[model samples]
Target: MLLNLLLLQCRAGFESECAAEFMQHCVDVGQSGFPRFDAQSGFVLFELYGDALAVIQAVSFRSLIFTRQWCACLPPFEQLPADDRLSVLLPAMTELPVCAELLAEVPDTTAGRELLPFAGKLASAMAQRLRQQGVMLPRKARADWRMHLFVLSGRHLLLGVSPRRNGSTLEMGIRRLKFPGAAPSRSTLKLEEAWHWFVPRAEWDARLGGGKTAVDLGAAPGGWTWQLVRQGMFVSAVDNGPMAESLMETGQVTHHREDAFGFAPGKPVDWMVCDVADKPARVAELMLQWALQGWCQEMIFNLKLPMKKRYQAVQQCLEEIAEGLEAAGIRFQLSARHLYHDREEITCHLDLRVS
Candidate 1:
């Protein structure tokens, strides 16, 4: 029997975890699929017997912890002439529905790094040719489809389409949020990526703008706290370690030398961010407590996973959090992802829905 395919990109070494999560999601939605993945390949393919669109619709990308980006798959082109690849690719382009943009990507692996320049050049050339041929829609056009070319090598690729409403907003599932040179640690990218993945940019002003207050648990060196302050939020930075002097100089942060778990805000704050190196369960409990007790209206935290049973561990932690929140009668929106910037950990965002 014929089966539809879905392509998912993820961090290398976690392909099994990603496949496990995808398979579980399919089972949860009553879709039957088997995932094909190899260790450290940085991508997974799911062959589904059911309607692919139905499965994609049932699973929101934001709720997926292991997947970085995904798309409905097309037949792989195994042989294209190196000198004139576009000639072969153009026919396929003509057959596809009009796409708003064309994105060329390579796997996130050592060997893939060598093809980055070629992939970018190819994408540029393809965009020009496809536009000239009217195969690609205009930039301002109201097109829903995005064309993606996953570069396997200079002469081969896996082509796919991702619908804008359900797929990643950025091309190739990569979030290119620039690193702030001023931020204290590289960990800043973790929170930045979480915001872009979980929160809509149009709603940033309303949800994370200035004059709001936040608490940064384990805020030493202030990576997460830097993000809060950058949003113009007054931050209570909780940690015993020294923070970045530049951040402290901003006068927007108040340091609390106390354990993040034991500390309580004088009143509810707009946001709470944590990057404490701790067990996933402990972090989940802290998140549930803050949300249930109304200590913070929103939170972004990290859950460091174990080397073995990573998927199971993540589910157990999330289930615990859900049960606690549900039992407390707290209305909340929770989303989790194993971000591109995260290693052995997943970022989670929780918003306490106000009645």
Candidate 2:
């Protein structure tokens, strides 16, 4: 029996966690698969014995916390001649069905970085050749599939495909979000990336723009608060530490010298964002409280995980939140991911919507 493959990209040091999560997901869906990974390699491969595409379809990308991006795999080509790597790759590209776009990527490691320029150049050449061969669809056509070329080195490559509906929106599974210099803290990138992942750019105005009131817990130096202010929303920055004076002067922000866990607003706000340093369970409970109490319609927070059994910790916290929300008769959508900018923690987004 032939097996199919799923390729996943994750943080370099957390390949084991990513592999463990992938295996658990496969088991949860009643699929049989085994994971292949190396610590600090920044990738995982799950080979499924049954209908691999069906298994991939059943798994939601948002639920896989340790994974940054993923794609379905085709047979890999090993040790091509240095002089004509494209010639070796072309046959494989032609064998596949139509693809909307081609993403040329390397592993997220020093070795991978060294091959980036080569991958970029190869991707460009492949796109042109695929178009000429009528193997690539036009931009305006419905994108059924995305081709992924993972360059192991100048001489070796792994080919994969992801259905448009289930794959990363970006070519390489990396969202290249720019960091604004004006933001008071680098941590601001976390919220910015979360919004990009959870909310569509077109819906930003209706869902998170002007007239929306937000509370930023642990808002000292105003990293998260700065994002809110930029959206033209009024923010109550809560913390014992001083916020960025520039952010405070914007007059769009009001600083509250108080504890985040104990603070509550005079009235319910549109959004609540937290980045406080606390135990993962404690942070999860805080998030559940705000949602259950109807303090905010939406929330985005971080959970700092323990050194051991990190995946189990996140799962337990999420289960607890679900039970609390269900008991409170609240309708909500919760999703979490270990963002590229994150270290030793994961970011979660919850939407407390009226049923």
Candidate 3:
């Protein structure tokens, strides 16, 4: 049986855009299914057919899960028809029992930090419920479920609702989580929310082929470098400043002690990660060089943004990068977005085909 699919992002202030792009991607990726934008109902719905659940599960395992959220929408939630059908689809509610009851009990009322906890509660409850239902969800289902949290209150509060079958009864619940009160005041080089980075790092580690050479630009405090080292990649950390004491001791991480712009590996690397907090255009240029010059086969990086015209700036950056790659006759696939953990910035994933 096919089910409707929906995707949600945790970052407050980014639902409509996230929903639009995510649904479009789902339409393309979902061969057994297609999206139905139910703006009237304020959610995107998909008509999924054979193996629809499997495809969603697959995408969610890959790049579909961002930050603390899962972008793939869980159906029946968006355009649900009745409560009885809901009962048949939900899980046991063991992992987060509070979620199963509380989510359904509370209306969207709170904001900010309180809301995210609500999301966590819901995820826990949903996992419990799914287990009871015998749905046999993938391991990632718990972590990525938050992406379905919708932004209804000026994008400040997030809400997520899902149902999993629990034998003859459907256990359903709703979850809400709040975003941070303010953006970072300084570039401390230490992540306030390391979990956000960790999840994506795990995803990257899984996708990376069994190669080990990596370069981490702007490697101070070593947050990004730490992940690379832990993945068993030999990392040349390039930064004029010192790395974190812990990461420096890892031994797998090499301190290049230089500027990222000027430093280059002796030979091509399997991966390059840049979180330099530089202008988007400059970052895009750097990525172009790395791709065109055969410096790296894959890259995961971030581009800081100007507050005004965020979309315009990002759009232009993508366009220019596309032109650059085209002019150089390089074959690549690139994706950029405002990550759930990001504030005034977006992460970019670029892969270049190498023979």
List of clashing residue pairs for candidate 2: none
> Which digits, one per residue and each the tens of the lDDT, describe model 3 over residues 1-355?
2334433323444334445455445556654554554322323344455443454554432343222233233333333223332243343222222222222221222433344554555445545655466543544344323223343222222233332221001111212223322212233232323223333545654545254889988877676776666567888989887887767676778888887888879999888888887888888888877887889978878888776666567778877887889898888777764543466687777778532
- Candidate 3 Cα outliers beyond 4 Å, as residue runs: 1-10, 15-211
| Alpha carbon lDDT of each predicted model | 0.84, 0.85, 0.53
lDDT of 1 by residue, 193-288 (tens): 888877888989999996899999989999899998999999999998999999999999999999988999999999999998888889899888
Per-residue lDDT value at 24 in model 1: 86
lDDT of 2 by residue, 1-355 (tens): 1328888898788888898888888889888878888878989888888765577678877678887778777766778898887777777776655787888888888988788899999888888887887888865678777788888977778887777787687755677778899999999999998998888899999999867999999898998999999999999999999999899899999999999999999999999999999999999999998987889999999998899998889899999999998887878898898887788989999998654
Q: Estimate each model's TM-score.
A: 0.93, 0.95, 0.55
The residue-level lDDT of candidate 2 at 184 comes to 91
Better structure of 2 and 3 per TM-score: 2
Ranking by TM-score: 2, 1, 3
Q: Indicate the worst ten consecutive residues by lDDT in candidate 3.
A: 166-175
Q: Rank the candidates by lDDT, best first.
A: 2, 1, 3
What would you estimate as the lDDT of candidate 2?
0.85
